[model samples]
Target: MADRDTVHYDGPAGGWGSLRGITRIFGKELPAPGVLDTLAHQNKPGGFMCTSCAWTKPAHHNPLEFCENGAKATLWELTTRRCTPDFFAGHTLCELKGWSDHDLEQQGRLTHPLRYDRETDRYLPCSWEEAFAAIGDNLKRLDPQSAVFYTSGRASLETAYLYQLFARLYGTNNLPDSSNMCHETTSISLKKVIGASVGTSVFEDFSACDAIFFFGQNTGSNSPRFLHPLQEAVKRGCRIVAFNPVVEKGLVAMINPQSPTEMLTGHETPISSHYLQVKAGGDIAAIMGLCKHVLDREDEARARGESVLDHDFIARHTHDFEAFTDKIRATSWEEIEDNSGLTRDALREAGEVYVEAERVIGIYGMGLTQQVHGFDNVAMLVNLLLMKGNIGRDGTGISPVRGHSNVQGQRTVGISEKPELVPMDKLARLFGFSPPMEKGLNTVETCEGVLAGTVKAFIGLGGNFLRAIPEQEAVAEAWQRLELTVQIATKLNRSHLVPGRAAYLLPCLGRSEEDRQAGGPQTVTMEDTFSCIHGSVGRRKPASEHLLSEPAIVAGIAKAVLAPNPKLRWDDWVGDYGKVRDLIEATYPQEFRGFNERLFTPGGFYRGNSARERIWKTASGKAEFTVPKELSATGFEDRPGRYRLITLRSNDQFNTTIYGYSDRLRGIEGTRDVLLINPDDMARAGLAEGQVVALASDADDGRERRVGGLKVLPFDLPDGCLGGYYPELNPLIPLSHHDVQSKTPAAKAVPVRILTGAAASG
Candidate 1:
């Protein structure tokens, strides 16, 4: 049975029309008529960044600032509901555990401060003054080093800038953010290959590309508003090659989300003339295949006395071409075909398209980052771009579609665990005192630290770290060890469930809600994927009058913790956060020039990272070649009945929250219980559509872990594989299991075994 609170519909999950099911982003029960005002702030006036995905959109004076998903994000944030401490009184930790994500949040916006009363098994309300004081008192209980501060992409640039400062000022460098969970690899790779970890292209880049390779991302669900650009690009004859295990309709739809003619008449813009389905972990091999095909064509051209390769660009702009070429030549055709889930014809077609295109763009999401060889997967694409001289030019570069709205922006304004993190270290030296020197934990490390008892306290600036993390049991164990858990968020989430022996749930303002103090109105900044820095403010009155903005919340905590009087007057910052901007200016030089003055300017500013020009800043000062791997994710190669299960968030989802039960594109609806399976695999297992089966972990060394049970159905999926919604399947993913180089959990690839009813009937 579905959790009692889940909204029920009578359709297949993915078949719902994009326009018909967008309301699922908010609780299906919430009321709304049409689009809401998106121009909530003036810090940038018409220069509003897309509030949805990291993908940029043209600044519009249009009233609908919110996309379908963006509306969900807004409505969910601005709901009239409130989940106060008294509400917690009715629900115990045990009771809440059985509640679905929607039910937990639908309980209402939390108004008063909340503290988990273990004796009562409920989180009773605590006052803000008491909550702040109690949190400080709890911090006084542990060594500052033992406390870990976690941040989410939901935080504003100002809040994050102040957050790192407070952690250092209070004496600890433990800052692990949502970045660790998603794109830690992109940050590590970009910072190493390029001088900075930001993208080179702007929104105009999409317009410039003759060929765009979209890997591991579904634009329709993730960036619905930005789909118009691709629609235009396709109309301009741009060739789009989509490489994902499950072919998303967004990549092939002949309709555009923004076009009224298309919307009124259901016309989708055609895309992905070539759809190559690569095995979950076979991205590197597929890239190698492309390289082989392109290089071989170059050889054929040379024999015919014709030019095929861009020899001049490769010689002057890049290095180690010979070694890279040798590796591609040495790779065997059979190996390539078997490793990648692609055929020679498909690979050849893709290579031909790339070779013909003048400007090429490679766009990827968690698909490229959430693998054991995820880093190698990206480097191959970068190598391909470099081979064709497709970088540093308009519309020609690698763009990693970020998960959260300002995930990359948070890093731009300085929230990082990078050991030699330049932003924080520079601020530390400029201000005073030594910043924490030890390499901080990424999301994976944070989980281990929690379980091992090395970490005792957790302070979150939005984001549900606990529920969002892989391995439910491991996360559950580490969470219980926290001496104090402080979550600064707008609504209830699973991270709040990780009650510290003493926990504090401090409600904060949402991006859609107005935030004002004695200083009139204030706006915070965010960084888009294009390295553009801009500002935003709230319009709808906050869900609750008691809510505090993230900056004010952080400032209040600092006041309570930095006792007796610290150098920075926390009170003054609370009084006027412009002073917070002053501190951010001092903390970050260069880009934020005349921080206060420039901010008042119409278009805020971009903290320029020019290496986005392909000026590799690595120790070698050249783009490094990451060696591809041969090992598939575990439990697959050596055992029968074991299969690879990749977890995904459906259309009505963003990270941890599930907005709707239906997935409009995949043709699923009214239920999230069905697992997507290849017809071949379904036949092999004798599983028919809607037959209930269990998804068990291959992680059982002594004890088995069951992620969830779902009805199997034949869907558009690759052979030898199955798929389902995530966090629900996250339990099967162990914390110990992650991409070694980047601490990102392999959410896209997990080794699992399918079982029939009653454990093993087959």
Candidate 2:
């Protein structure tokens, strides 16, 4: 193992440091001609939407609206280097499997369709027709229920719609997506409370909000574009509160690159007027505490002949208020303080901020979603917002910050394992086929099916499925059992390296590359976190002429796999993507009406939200409040040497893709094999700074899951809570330890035992 470098990163979130990182990637990758121009086009009208975070673009465009990571995503896709046939011929699959994920992708983009040759242990070039035929044959051999179709968030709305449509038409509803792993809890909880599965507020609400509550989301590294709005909100005296285990630099202070004065003078805009370091798996308790204080204040106000609770709105548009308050009042402050790892004064302060604000926006991410009680965490936040009648109001609503650019859009276009969510009747009417009604597999269920030898074939649109899934070794073993695996991607990842009995890599056009079909240059649409649907058209030439658009690839497979159906025009749809949009509009008339024409409009259009209109689509015809059964914090009380582990992404990385080994914002450099633990926990565990340790799962499932050679770094974290970089620490998470409702892996809160000295070196 190599020695890791650790340094203190004292600079503000986005300054010269961020600019340097963006230029460094571009300098090394050396993208194609006119590739740099794509930056100017990003987030602008009639230009390509960023493939980075799902932060909504402002109604008015700026000259340089793109952020640092956005630039990295564009340049990463537009790299000049190509993985041609010659490159594959020189390196066998076994040889390539030894390379690090970063090094493998750094070799450059895949330029052709390649099939794995088991005899030679090599991936050789193959024609697109042959590849598609092989996939068709595999599908025909297996039962429709035995195949899982996975969609990545990077896929365009058209591609995802067609992908799910093909799966359902072929008599299967097994449409799993990236959402199953990340924000499924948000969808499940919000749908139960607000009758909708998405955020209720739009980008414009940011300016009107009096207070913004950020939970478990690192706006700086994960979604830097959000910092701009937050900066403006702070300037206008808007109170910003952050709740997380780690105090992120972006949430602490941010330096806007677009502001010349701040950039020149090193003046940083402070974010998060109040920062609360909630322990892992303690969000539910913390939120309940806030609600408890709010309800108490409301009672006091009522006694004084003043109304603090939105009585008029609650009486008109809500349900189960008394039951919800009963639960909140029953929660003791002792439990809240013990579980939340904070004082009652802190909870009271947060509640005071919430009470004083006229309008508030609650924003959260995976930090609250990747836990056993993830749904409850989200529901508690909703419960607090409901007390003030925050929903269906300007600048006051719930916002679940999505990680992917089009993740929400993919769900909107029917990329779900649940068949009921898909409009089968609409599809049958439009395309004249009996769509599958049987429920399919989610990400977790798909992995279980693979392990059980039930799911024989897997087709991935664009993602590192094996690495992103929990129980890395078990997932790898399941992959080896599959009959066939197909990867449609732009660059090489670990999933491509682990071939099944037969695997094929089909390279596709990236987001930054032009997708010119028979109809000429085309544009694709994406729905941001705010439900704003907009068009994204690429100006840069394709990295390789051989690369096909994702939609085209899905169409080819569909044409080959499904039996002849007169209503389905796979070829025609591939020739012109607008036809796909037209069909989408026809299928989802309520949301996508005039979708094609709206793409030409400035800033695109908003997908009208029913919850925002106060039209409750719930069982009671009103917004319902849910009460959590238990508000206790999670801890390893039975196990002596155990701590709660929270997996995190590095500043330079997105999800499982590592841009670099260093997490510059956290003062780490040159390596990712370090763990961030509370200094007090380190002392209790008899560990010192820079001491190497091995983390073993305390899941007690009789499976030995451990990651060795992790250096310990003491930092300011809640006691008994440890933090480590993801994909590396993913092995510690068990597939069985997931949320009961959402089925999302509990990556945020894993019980683990730290081993030092000889055990660590092993």
Candidate 3:
């Protein structure tokens, strides 16, 4: 690991750095010819989706719609490297667990179905029929509640819909997915206040908005494609404001790699007009401060016989406006400034810019959703937008930038643990079976169940559950107690190493690979961040002949588990995905009314958010304004030697899938074990640059959660805070440290302490 060399990159995002990233991936993963042709088809009509972020594409296609990370994801899938049974035979399960996450994936794509053999301590090849049969037999012997079906965001609408249907028919609502960990707060908070779970804004709103307020979203790394519209918006005089703990390079400025003028002239487009360095987990307080500034100015404007708040819009379309404003008035400037890490004057200046704009859009990411007060954070943001009549307008609304390509779509198709969120009546009528009405376990709850030895089986649709979750060591240990484990994936990951007694690794087709069934070559659909449903048809051949389509694999397992029923034709549905769409339309008629027709049309179609139409599904039948009871966004109190740890993804990573060790954006290369801290905090704690320190959780759970040998690197961050890569720092975040309502792990705000000397070894 090269820890001593720190290169401060000054160039804007998406310049030579992005180009080098693409070339490096191509050299390592896609050495085959015709790769460029396949990449050109990405995010275009009659082509596959980017298969990365949920960020949607425009109606008019750009020659290169994909970004560096997007290209890495695409080429990573199309790699010729194969992980055959022979490769598994060379290493034992116990030995593979010691490898780094990047090295494990670099072993290549899984080309065959594998079954773990305890006798040899290695994975052996197995037929699909044998694997499905064994899984069915194990599931039959256990209670439905003991089995957890976890889906990643990579699964398509057809696959997710079928997966949910299979789980419901199996008599359990234990369908925990990747959404539970990342954006569950968005669904929970937005649904309660705005009557819809998804964002109300469309992609085109970026062009029409007068101002865009960014809250805790790192656009350069997580969703680089978004930088284009933001750059265009800046050129057209749209005021962009950002509130985040780290001063992200992407938000500062960007150079479009595709723009020849920028590349030739080295011109960097400034993104955020104002960047506020708010404390980690202090979003609620900061937003409240903005609200207070606006309300105070509203009072001055009223005295001068001029209005700031939209009284007509609030009275006609919203409820509880007075109570919400009263709470804002009660909050003192001292409390706001202390908690938010921003001065009152700074907030007022940003608020003034916001008030000057005729229309605005609020865009956020996991930063606002992965905290203890994540639900309140989202609610307060909505309150600010509702105060200005930002919702349900042409150039205004909220946009929760999702990480996975199909995570939102999975929730839309009933992959939720909460039964009430789905239309149980419609499902029962269509499927001819009584669906489980009880609430099931979420990601955190599922971890608890596994640790307690209650969850007997785990079936993953795509993601690496063990690597992506919190309490890594504890969860991995508990996973060994499972009776059966099944992973349907295209490539090898860490989750496959910690297999259950009767574990099976089933290789599936990638999004870039064609899926040919009995009916014909079929295309799957995914709902983007903006709620637009688009079709994705793969153009490349399968990586291996043995690889099965996700829908086919799901149906195969479902048929083997359930008794032959006349109502559900598992074979026919898998044979023809159109039948799956027919059922999906029948289940959610309002959202997918003309599913097939609209899916094939140009640019697809929007599912339409009721909140966007001012049709509040809340009990009050109007948009709501919620008041904060406290100023602190994180519930934890300040203490000596305690620092709030913020978990982040590097530029070379997407979720738990790490592409490389180098974080080009932050200028950290060849190591993910470094901790970023402020220079003042480092001096106060008696720590030196490149010092290896241990981070131990400060939770009162009586458990010792520590990560050792993290080199300390001085950074520009808020006081009393540290930034570290996720999964490596995930152990420091307890499962109990989550939003009470949304149950999303507070990965963004973990309380911890640094230890030196002999303690660093543990």
Candidate 4:
């Protein structure tokens, strides 16, 4: 770990501290002079969406709708710094690899197209025509299955639609994206249980709900804008219950920066009424305990000829109710307490709160999804909601908080690895070509394919793929063997340095920059977490004159690689983005009906969820409940010195993008390599605060997975649990350690051994 210091913060989330944060960023990043004027338009009518989290905006927008993190994202995008060909010529690939992720991002936006010069170990400026020609040449030589088309959350819906179209026309379904990493479990699990792949609740539900139950979400760091709603709900007497390993400050209390009263008085509204520090990977067990409590109440109610359960609603709108209750009845309190790390009394109290509320909204984040039983965990939460008839009504439903800005929109436009998820038949009819029908590779499979020398090329629309992926050591080695690598991004990142034999770096316009075409300025749409699609138009000028809009870039690549079709003209789509939206409407008529017209509506349109209407598209035509065979959430046996490793993002970080070294909320500054463990676990491992240590995975794989020189920072985490930053701890996660169903990496629950003494010196 780098030189670091620790301090305690007693203030709530988003207070004067947030104001100071923005001020510090202005000095550090030195953004364009009129950046503040551009930020004012964020999430407003005829303005761009905040490029941070995928949280939805309120119907009546706030003046300063953007949060501190969102503002940071805007400033980060509009920074005055620029990375030109001169910067690339000055540093070799080997030398650039030595710089940290934060330092690389600080180098600013890329200004031109570049190609790797193997002889000089540097990247040289190249024309877009030459770059596209070279990529087309390399791709045609390889089997279509050997290539993987990857997209990040930054890609707009229009861009994503064209991207998937280009890939399918290229004769492959190998389109894997950022969703494969985070919310794949939510997508697959929700579809099975409720016949919907998205959260049923909307932003309005927060204000109308009687209670909100949070599972494994850190609202302060993930999406600070969400804190305002929680604050309002708390003030209005809505109950908030949280279950998480770390004592997330956001859930405990919040001082809304948008509220003039709170800002003037420095008053903090307590968010969560009851906070349960569930152990890492203990969400499933804890949820089971709550279900058992509800079941007990149902039994009592039945004896008295009354019912706490929604028997009428359950009978009419659900299936597998008896089977679900039977399993909950069979579960003993001892097993629940042992695995959940919560006592019977505590669960009963929480259950009482759930039972007392007329309407409750169930909310969760990656804490429940990035696990061995991620699907099971999410399904179990839905089961709890079904018992209380919380499925089809205002202020009641399941909400899986999505992390990326357009991750949901990308999936909406068919950027999935699953063949059955997208309407391939509809696409085939529209394009007059046979689209690929076979299943494609997800994130983990893509990595495995690369390691096996089967996947030869990777084309990334956006994202630092090498850093975002797990098994960093292995993937980094396998990445070098690829025949071609192409990255289209706004800034310089570590992934750009890991070029293949034939690599190209293409610069693209950011979300806040203007995109001009033949028709005029264009707007792209993004789907928020609640299935709401809205338009986003850039306010400022482009970062570089050479940069192209994502849609234009996709069209250019498609033109160069595929055979010209008389029916489809790539040039038409590039000149006017409305043409792209029109095609999207043609493909998915129900969802995108009146696509262009509805996109300009004040708050945009809702892509309706059938589950919310009590219309289950499942086999049984009703909501179903699922039960897990195993009680252990991590699926790992108890072993001494082995702890469940939970990877986390710092307050200064967003996904794989490192804004700075300090984590303000956690009180750790100047380093990102510190481990947070419980005081008891630290002593149990014969460790002390500030001790240099190492972590090694308990995976049975023959390969050693270890990262040393991590400074131990005692925290309020549950015993037998450890917390560390992602990418730094990704090396400790084995490739096979993922959900078998969704193939999402089990970053939340990796069995690892804390190494000290001799091992620490490695």
For model 1, the superposed segments whose C-alpha errors exceed 4 Å read: 1-16, 23-35, 38-51, 60-65, 564-566, 597-604, 631-638, 700-703, 760-762
Residue lDDT tens for model 2, 384-499 = 88889888889889999999999999999899988778788999999887888888999999989888889999999999999899988888877887899999999888888888
Clash totals for all models, in order?
25, 0, 0, 0
Model 4 earns a TM-score of: 0.98
How high a TM-score does candidate 3 get? Answer: 0.98
lDDT of each: 0.72, 0.87, 0.89, 0.88
lDDT of 4 by residue, 582-627 (tens): 9899988999999999876766689899999999988799999888
Q: Give candidate 3 misplaced runs (Cα > 4 Å).
A: 1-7
* Cα RMSDs, all models: 4.0, 2.3, 1.9, 2.1
After the best TM-score superposition of candidate 1, give how far the Cα of residue 311 lies from its true spot, in angstroms: 2.2
lDDT of 3 at 336: 90
> Per-residue lDDT of 432-493 in model 3, one digit per residue for the tens?
89999888889998999999999999999999999888888999998998999999998889
Q: Which pairs clash in the backbone of model 3?
A: none
Off by over 4 Å in 4: 1-7
**Model 2: colliding residue pairs:** none
Model 2 residue 154 distance off true place after TM-score fit, in angstroms: 0.6
Model 4: which residue pairs collide? none
- Rank candidates by lDDT, best first: 3, 4, 2, 1
